[model samples]
Target: MKHRFFPAVAALLAFGAAHAAPCPRDAPLPSGFERWAHPGLGVAAWQESGTYQATLPLGRAVTLHLPDIGTVHFIVPPGGKGSHGPYGGMIGIDVPSGATYRVMLSGRAWIDMVQDRADLPSSAHQHGPDCTGIAKIVSFPLHAGWHVLQISGAPDPTITVMMSSTP
Candidate 1:
C-alpha cells in the first residue's frame, strides 16, 4: 500500500498543476462588494475570515485557493447541498449556467452535487491514490440564476478561498 502511495501523490500533483490556473490564490469579492464591506480585495480570501459568498458571472472561470489544513464544505443553494472536502489546493469554477457549471475540486473530500433536493450526486471522489490531496473535477448542472456559494468545515481558525478567471 505504501509503495504505491508515492506514485499516487505524484500523479495527483501533476493533475492539479495542469488545472492550476483559472483558479488563482485569491477569491474575488462580488462585483462592488467594497461599497458595503470595505474589506478590499484579497482581504477576504479565506472561508472563515471574511465574505464567503460571491456572484459568478456566466462563462467565467475562477479559482479558490483552499487552506493548507482542514476540511472545507462548499454549498450551492436551490438544493442547498454542500460538498465536504479536504484542505489545500484550488477549486476551479466555470459558470456558463447552473446546468453547465463546472467545479474542479482537489484534495480529500466528498462531493454531493444534486440538481434536485431529493437526488444525490451520481458519483463521489474519496481520498485515496487517485484522490489523494485532491479529488477529480466534478460538474453539477443546476438552474440558471445567481446561486449562493457557501464554505465551511475548515479545521483552521482561518482559511482563504481564491477566485480568478480561467483562460
Candidate 2:
C-alpha cells in the first residue's frame, strides 16, 4: 500500500508541475489573442433568469461573473455537469453572421452555445498559447441571431472571456 501511494503522489506532483503558469495581467497576448491584452469590461452573470442580463461583444475581453453552479438555470445541461467547480453562469451574444466563432476562457471551464432553445455543438477545441493567460478555446459554428453562452463548472467566481469570429 505504501509503494502504491508513493507512485500516485509522485504522479500528482508531476502533473501539477507540468501545468503552465498564468501570464501577467499586463503582459502582451500572442498574435491570435492580441485583443485580449487590454482591460476587459466587467459584467454580472444572470442566475435563474432566462433573460439576458449582459451581452458579450466580439473581439473584446469581458470579466464575467460566474454565479454558484447550483443556482444557475442553464438553457441546457452542460457537458461538464460533473465539474467540481462552484461557479457558473450564462450570458447573451449576438452573432452578426453565420460563421465560426471561438470562445476563449481565462481558466478551465465548460462552455455551451445555445440557440433557439437548443445546444449547438462545438466544432473544435484547443489550448491557449504558452504564457498567454488563456486556458482554453472552443469553437462553434453559429448563425446570425441571438444566442446564449452558458459557462459552467468554473473554479473561480469571475473569469476573463472573449469571442472572435474566425478570419
Candidate 3:
C-alpha cells in the first residue's frame, strides 16, 4: 500500500511539472513604463486592471515627488523639438482626518482626489501646457480616511509622488 501511494504521488508531481506554464521571456515591456527609485520614501508600482498602480507612505511632512513628463528632443538647425509622455495610472491612499499633504509634480498632470461619500466634492489639480517640463508643488488638506487618487496626464519616466505632513 505504501509503495502504491508513493507511485501515485510521484505521478501527480510529474503531471504538474509537465503542465507548468513557462515565463514569457520574449514578451515586450509595457509602453511608457520605466524603473524608478527614491531614497527613504518607500515607493513601489504595479500594473492592475489595465492601469498602473503606485503607493507610498504619507508621513507627517507629506510630499509627493513625480518624475518629468516623458522626454524631449531639440534640434538647432531648424529649431524643432517633440516629446510624448507615458501612460497614466491610479494611486490609492488613506489620510488621517484634518491632515494636509503636498504633491510635487514634475510635469503636466491632471490630479483628481475623491472619496466614496457622494456628498464630498472631488478635488482636482492641473499643471501643463503653460508649465510643461517644470516642477510644480501643490499643497492641499484632506478630510481623512481612504481616498482614491486618479492621476491622468502624460506618462513620465521619472515622475515622483511624495506626501508629507504640514507643520
* lDDT of each residue in 111-158, candidate 1, tens digit only: 333322233353322221231222334444455433333333333333
Worst 10 residues of 2 by lDDT: 43-52
**Candidate 2 vs candidate 3: which has greater lDDT?**
2
- Residue 126 displacement in candidate 1 (angstroms): 10
Q: For model 1, give the 10-residue run with minimal summed lDDT.
A: 35-44
Reference-based lDDT, residue 137, model 3: 45
Cα error, residue 47 of model 2, in Å, equals: 4.2
Number of backbone collisions per candidate: 20, 0, 22
Q: Candidate 2, which segments miss by more than 4 Å at Cα?
A: 1-27, 47-51
For TM-score, candidate 2 versus 3, the one ahead is: 2
Residue 132 of candidate 3: its Cα lDDT? 26
Model 2 residue 165 CA deviation (Å) reads 0.5
Give residue 153's error in model 3 in angstroms.
Answer: 1.0
